[model samples]
Target: MTELDRLASDFGNAETAIALTGAGISAPSGIPTFRGDDGVWKRFDEGQFTYGRFRSDPAGFWADRLELHREMFGGEFEPNAAHDALAALARDGHLDAILTQNTDGLHRDAAFVGDDSPADGITDAADATILELHGNARRVRCTDCGNRTEAEPIFDRAADGERPPTCDCGGVYKPDVVLFGEQLPGAVIQRARSLARESDVFLAIGSSLAVEPAASLPRLAASSGATVGIVNLESTPCDGVADVVCREDVTEVLPRLRDLAASG
Candidate 1:
């Protein structure tokens, strides 16, 4: 049997299968990876995104953030083949959960891949099934009142010289994402770790598997007796430890795996 066949077998037979995705999965959807050659960091100053800067100069930080957001989500973006595959796998009960490091919301958007309306098995962001390791970009949170709301209006407020948009409670609004110097939400990370330990077949897709805490998940799954699969165009730190390593375009590989798993 081929490596993909083995992966399909495991996916089909396992009681709990999870997919851990990173920026690579979103690259095909026109969202550039931060470390890639045409990455956002290469053009923009990463220093402007730290939690320190947001607190020190909210106006300057918001201005820079608006520019950065445009650079990332400036165009008409849609979920690609890989995202559709994961969503399909989840819909068909082949994948129990998707733990994504991407804040792009592609996985959540996959629910509307074809139709404009929500699909049958939509994975709501508020649900634990689709865990966003980093916070969602579609939201903005009040720094003082902690009110979470849609980002467009907040971004518009910032654009109209609110600098850092102020909440009704007299608090500043910030993108609900984890900044460079900000810690990820404690409860979210704890739940992610728990999922990693509980998985039966873990697929590490499109991630370099280098970032801490997240990078440790594939290894944790492997050591916990789950079969680990890594699929990426480039070699990752965890490639050596992965039970199956496939160097293929994520957009192609995942859909094929989805088909195989469904058939089996």
Candidate 2:
């Protein structure tokens, strides 16, 4: 059988599957991966453009990163097949959880039929419980008081026309994403660890296993005796360790898995 077919069959037999996704999964939908040739890390100077720099000059941080956020928001990107398929699997009860390293929030959006509505027939969209190891870009938080707020309310402010926004506590507001120098969210890390420990099958899709903490989740699952599968365009750090490694497009693999889950 083909690699996708094998994955589908194995996934069907598994009791609980957890998927971990990174930027490669989002690339087909127009998002860029970091550290790749055309990635953000290569394009920008990490010293001046990250959370550490923000700590030095809040104004400059707002000036540089806010515009990037606004541009991304205005871009015509949508959830690609891979993202939709993952949500479909979760909705159909094949996937126990989704652990994403992406800040794009596409996975969450795909799960919802509407903002107010739960997933169509799925029990609770919220319960599917996507743990974003990296923070989300769909919202903003104040660096000063840790206030989480809606991004829509202040999208214009993040754009060039006005002075930057501040928290209720009078500190600079920034996107909810974890910047280069910032650490991953502790709550998310805990949730991911729990899911990894409980999973029967762990699927690592579109990740190179290059980043820390997030890269460790698959290892946790594997070490805990879960069947580990990896699907990526390129070889990953975990390639030698994974039970099954498919060097293919995530868009192709995820849809097949979703289809298999539906049939089961």
Candidate 3:
């Protein structure tokens, strides 16, 4: 049998199947991966958006960040096949939890039917089935009061010449995303650890697996007796330990896995 078929068979029978997704999953949606040939860093300076820069020039940083946001999220960056497949897997009960390192809201947007969803009979997710490791870009947080709002309004204000959008409490609004030199949310990380430890099957999809803590998850699952699978375009540090490895396209891989699992 093909590796994907075997993965599907295992996933179909597994009680708790979880996946950790990375930038590669979003690449097909026209969002650039953080590394590799056409990475964002290659076009923009990573130093310009660091915590240090944000602290030194909040106004300029916000303006620059608004531009950066336009550059990143400007397009019709809809969820691609890989995303829909994961959502379908979760919807069909073949997948349990998803731990995504992407700040893009595609997973949540695709999986959960919100007020904007057009699909019929798809209810909202009652639990935290998808955990964001690096926070979401679609939200804005107040620096002073810590209240968050949708980023669109703040971006609108910024576009209308408000250099840094301020909250009602007179606090500056920052993109809710975790910038460089920022720590991942502690509460989310804790839950992710528990999920990894409890999973019967763990799939590491499209991640470089070089980043710390996140890179440790697949290993954590394996150590806890979960079968670990990895699907990525390039080889990662965890490739040596993964029970199943696929270097094919995620768009093709995830959908086939979903279909096969459902049929099984």
Tens digit per residue, CA lDDT, model 3, 1-264: 988889899899888999999999998999877678888778878888987777778888888898788888878888999999998988888888888888778888787644332111112374337777887788888889888777877898999998788999998888887888877667778878998999999999989999977899999999999889999999999988789999999999999999999998
What is the alpha-carbon RMSD of candidate 1 to the true structure?
Answer: 3.7
- List pairs with backbone clashes in candidate 2: none
Cα RMSD for predicted model 3: 3.9
Candidate 2 yields a Cα-based lDDT of: 0.75
Q: Give the root-mean-square deviation of each candidate in angstroms.
A: 3.7, 3.8, 3.9
Cα error of candidate 1 at position 86, Å: 0.3
> Which ranges of candidate 1 are over 4 A from the true structure?
112-128
True-structure lDDT of candidate 1 = 0.84
Whole-model Cα lDDT of every candidate shown, in order: 0.84, 0.75, 0.84
lDDT of 1 by residue, 23-65 (tens): 9999999997888788889999898899999999999999999
Clashing pairs in 3: none
How high a TM-score does candidate 3 get? 0.93
Give the deviation of candidate 2 from the true structure as CA RMSD: 3.8
